[model samples]
Target: MVLQGALGVSLTFNCGDTDVAQEAVERSFAIASERGDPLDRLRLLGPMQMLYFRTGRFGTALHYARELAAVAEELGDADAATLARTFKGVSFHLRGDLRSAREELEGALSGRPPKEVASYLGFEHFLAAIFLARTFWLMGDTDLALEQTADVVSSSEESGHPLSHVITLMWAVTVFLWQGDIEAAENHIDRLETRAAAHGLQAYLAVADGFRGEVAVRRGDAAGGAQRIRAALKELHAARYELLTTPLNVTLAEALCAIGHHAEALEEVRAAINLVETNGDLVYMPDLLRTRGRIEAAMGPRKRDTAEATIHEAVTLSRRQ
Candidate 1:
C-alpha cells in the first residue's frame, strides 16, 4: 500500500498534478512512519522534496531534505545521504545562497557511490551535477561550468534515464542562455522539447517554450516572443510550477522593454523583484535588478538616479555571490 501510494506521487507529479502528488506523498509518508520503515520513509521524501521544490516552497523542501539526510545517516546509507545533501544544496541555490550551495554540492560530489547505490537512489547524482554546473556558471566559471554540465548531459543520456536526460538538457540550455550563446541555447531547447513531448512532461514542455520565447526576444522579435512567453507562463502557472517564474518574468520584462513598453516592463520587473525579496530567492536577484534598472533608465532622465542605484545594487550583489 505504501509503495503504491509512493508510486502515485511520482505519477501525479510527472503529470503536473502537484496538489494531488503532495497529498499522495503525505499519505505514503504517514504509512511508512507507522510501519517504522526507514527506507520507505526516505523513498517518500524524494517526491515530497520535488513537489515542494517545483512549487517554489524552498523552505519546506529544505526541511524534507534535512530530514532525509538524518534518516539516511541513521540507516547507514551513504548514497542516500549524499543525495539528501545535494538536495539541500539545491534548495540553497534556489534561495540564492550560492556560497553554501556550492559547499554542500561539492562535498557530495567529492565521493563516488557504487553504481548500484546510485541507481537505487534514482539518478539524484545527476540532478546534483546539474545544479553544481549552474552554481559554477553563476560564480563566473563559464568554461568549467560548461565542461561539468556537458559531462552530466552525456552521462544522463547513457544512463537510460530519459527524464533525467531531458532535465539536464534544460539546465544546459539555461547555462547557454546566460552565456549569450543563442545558437547553443536553441539547440538544447529543441532537444529538450523533443524529449519532453515524447514523455508527455507538461512542465518541461512549458520550460522549453519559455526558453524559445527568450531566444526569440533576444533575436529582436519582441511581439512574437512575448506572445510565446505569455502562453508558456499561463501553462506553468496552471501547473503551479512557480520555480521558473522569476526567470520567465525577467525574460518577459526584457521583451517588453525591447518594444518600447517601459511602463509594462517596469511593472513586470518590479513584481518579480518583490517576489524574490519576499521569498528570499536570490539566485535570480541580479537579473531582476538589472532588468529593473533598464526599465527605470527607459523612463527618462528623471529616473536616472534610481536606475544607477538599482544597477549598482545588482552589481554589488552579483559580485558578493
Candidate 2:
C-alpha cells in the first residue's frame, strides 16, 4: 500500500489520470492509518496532504499537515517535522490566515538552514519559503516578500534538487508576475519550461505553458495568449489541479480585458473569486477583486462608481491583512 501511495504521486505528476491517482493516494492513506507502521503513515500523509492542498481542499490539507507534524514529533524526525510545518503554513496562507502562515513558515525555516531540510513527499523548505514570500506580499511586506522569493531560488539552485528547482521557478512566477516584472517572469517561464520538460515534470510544464501565455498577453498577443492559457488551463483542470487555477484565470482575465472583452474578463475574475471562496483558498481574493475592478472600469463610465468601490474593497482587504 505504501508503494501504491508512491505510485499515486507518480500518476498525479507524470500521468494525467487524476481521478485514479487521487483514489490510489486516498486508499493508501486510509490503509496506512488503519494498519501500516508509523513510518508508513508518515510516508502516506505527505502525499495525501499534497493531493488535498492542490485540489483546493485547504481544510483537509491542514488536517493532514497537523497529523503529519504530530507523527513526525512522535518519531523524533526533525526533518519530517520541518516539512510538516511548512505544509501547515502553506495551507494557512491559502486559507487567508497570513499571520499564522508567516509564523509557521518562519518557524519552519528558523531552527535550521533550509539546506538541512529534507524533501518529504512533495514539500521542502523551498515550498515553505514560496508561500512565506507570498504571505509577506499579501500582508504588505513587499521588500520581505521579494527577499524571501530570491532566497527560495538561490537555495533551490544550491541544493541541486530538480523538484526544488521546478517548485521554486514554477511558483516564483507569481511574485514576479504580480510585481509586473515581465522580463523576469518570462525568463523564469522559459527556464521552467526547459527544466520541466527535461525532468518529465509534465504538470510544471503545463504550468509553464500557461505562464508563457500570460507573457504573450503582455507582449501584445492577447488572442494567442488567451487561447494558449485556456488550453493549458483545461489540461490542468482535468488533472484536478486548483492551486494555480486562480492565477491562470487572472491572466486569462487580463487577456480578455486587453482584447476589449470587458464582460468576459469581469466574469472570469468573479469566477476566480468564487472558487477561492468556495475552496477556502482566499489567498488570491484581493488580486481577483482588483482584476474585476479593472475590468469594470474598462466597461465604460457608467461602471466607474462600481469600479472604484470594487478597487477600494480590494485595497481594504489587502490592508486588513
Candidate 3:
C-alpha cells in the first residue's frame, strides 16, 4: 500500500497537478499512521514536505520537516535523515535564511556517503544538488553553480531520472543567461523543450517555455518571447501552481521591456514582485527586482535612478555570503 501511494504521488507530481499529489500524500500519511512504522512515516513525510515547499507553504513545510526529522532519528536511516535535512534546508532557503539553509544542506551532505546519495531515490541527490547550486547562485558564485549543475546533469543521466535531467537543464539555462551566453542559453532551452515533450512532462515543459522566453528576450525577440511566456503562464495556471506563476510573469516583463513596452513591462514586474512578496519567496525575489529595475531604466529619467538603485540592491543581495 505504501508503495502504491508513493507511485501515485510521483505520478501526480510529474503531471503538474499539486491537488492530486497532495491527496496522494494525505493517503500515504493515513496508511503510515495505521501501520505505525517509523520508516514508513518518514518516507511519507518526504513527499508531503516537498509538496508544501513547492507550493510556497513554508510554514507547513517546516512543520513536516520537524516531524520527518524526528521520524528519521527514530528510524536511524542515514538517507532518511539526509532527505529530511534537505527538505528543511529548502524551507530555510526560501525564507531567506541563507546561513541556516547552507548549514542544513551541509549537514545533510555530511550525513550521506558520496557514492550513495544519488542511488537511493529519485529526489535523494537531485534536490541536494539543486539546493547547493541555488545556494551558490544566490551567493554569486557562478563557477560553483556551474560545477554543481554539471554534476547534477551527469548524475541524472546516469540514473535515468528524467525529471532531474529536466530541472538540471532549466538551471543550466539560468546559469547561461546570467553569464550572458545567449547561444548556450538558447541551446539548453531547445534541449529542455525537446526532452520534456518527448517525455510528456508538462511541468518541466512549462519551465522550458519560460526559459525559452527568457532566451528570446535576451535576443531582442520580445513579441516571440511574450508569446512563449504567456503560454507558459497559462500552463502553470492550468496546473494550479500559483507559486510558479511569478517566474513566468517576471519573464514576460523582461520580454515586454525588450520590446520597448516599458509601461506594460513595469506593470508585469510589479505583479510578479507582489506575488513573490505575498508568497514569501525570497529565492525568486532577485529576478523580480532586476526586471523591475531594467524596466524602470528603460522608462527614462523619471525612474532611472530608482531603477538602478533597485538593481544594485538586488545584485548586492544576490552576492551576499
Candidate 4:
C-alpha cells in the first residue's frame, strides 16, 4: 500500500498535478522509506530524483541521485546504476559543470552497445544524450554537438517507443533553433506537435506551441511571436512544467526587444536569471545573461556600461563551462 501510494505521488507530480502532488511528496516518501523493502525504497528514490530535477532543484536532485546510485549498487542492479549516472550527468549539466557533466554522460553511454541503450537509458531514452549535445554546443564544439544531436534523433526514432520519439524531438529542436536554422526547428516542431497530439501529451503540445513562437521570432514576427510564446508559457507554468521556460524566455526577451519593449524584456530576463540562480540551476544562465546584455545594448548609450558588464560576465561564464 505504501509503495503504491508513493508511486501514485510520483505520477501525480510528474503529470503536473502539483497542487496535491507537492503536499504528498514528502509524506509519501517518508512512509515508503520506513516500511518498504529496499527495492521499494529504490522505486521512490528514482521518481524523487526526477521530481527535484524537473523542479530545478539541481543540488537536491543530485543528492537523491547519489542515494539512488548507492542503493542500486547495493542491489547489484547495473541498469539502475546507469540511470543514476545519467541523472547525475544531467544534474551536473544543469548546474553549469560541463566537464563533469560530459564525463558522467559519456561514461553512461560509453560501455554499452547501441542495442542495450534503449533499455539501459530507460524506454524513453531520455535526456542524457540530449543534454550532452547542448553541453557540447555550449563548449563551442558545434560540429560534435550537431553530430551528437543527429545521432540522438536517429536513435530516438528507432527506439520503438512513441513517447521517446516525441521527447527527443521536443528537446532536439533547440539545437536547430540555436543554430538559427528555423526551417529545421520548424520541421521538428511540427513532428513534435503531431506526436504529442497523437499521444495526448498535452504538456508537450503546449511546449510545441512555444517552439513555434520561437520560430516566428527568428523569422521576424516579433510581436506575434512574443504574444504566442507568452500564452504558452502561462499554460506550461500553470501545469507546473518548467523545463523549457528558460529558453522560451530568452526567445521572448529577444522578441520583446525587437518590438521596442526593451524595459519589459530586461525585466523578463532579469527575473529569469534570478530564478536560475536561486534554484542553483545554471543550465540557462549564460544564454539568459547574453540575452540580457543584448537587450541593454539595444537600449542605446544610456545602458552601455551595464550592457558591457553583462556581456563580459556571460562570456566568462560560458567559457568557464
Q: Could you report the Cα RMSD, in angstroms, for every candidate shown?
A: 1.6, 2.0, 2.8, 2.5
Per-residue lDDT of candidate 3, residues 98-194 (tens digit):
7788888878778546566533346556676767777777766788887877777677667677776776777677767777888878888888888
What TM-score does each of the candidates earn?
0.95, 0.92, 0.87, 0.91
Q: In angstroms, how far off is 95's CA in candidate 3?
A: 2.9
Span of ten consecutive residues with least summed lDDT in model 2: 114-123
**Candidate 3 overall lDDT versus native:** 0.75
Q: lDDT order of candidates, best first?
A: 1, 2, 4, 3
Candidate 1's residue-wise lDDT over 173-286, tens digit each?
888988899998998898898998888887899988988899999898988999999999998888888778889899999899989999999999988888878766678999
Compared with the true structure, all predictions reach lDDT values of 0.84, 0.84, 0.75, 0.80
Clash-forming residue pairs, model 3: none
Error of 1 at 32 (Å): 1.3
C-alpha-based local distance difference test score of model 1: 0.84
Backbone N/Cα/C clashes per model:
0, 0, 0, 0
Output the lDDT of residue 291, model 2: 89
Q: lDDT tens string, model 2, 84-178?
A: 78888988888777888999898888887655566665446778888888888777788998898888888887777888888898889988887
Model 4 clashing residue pairs (backbone)? none
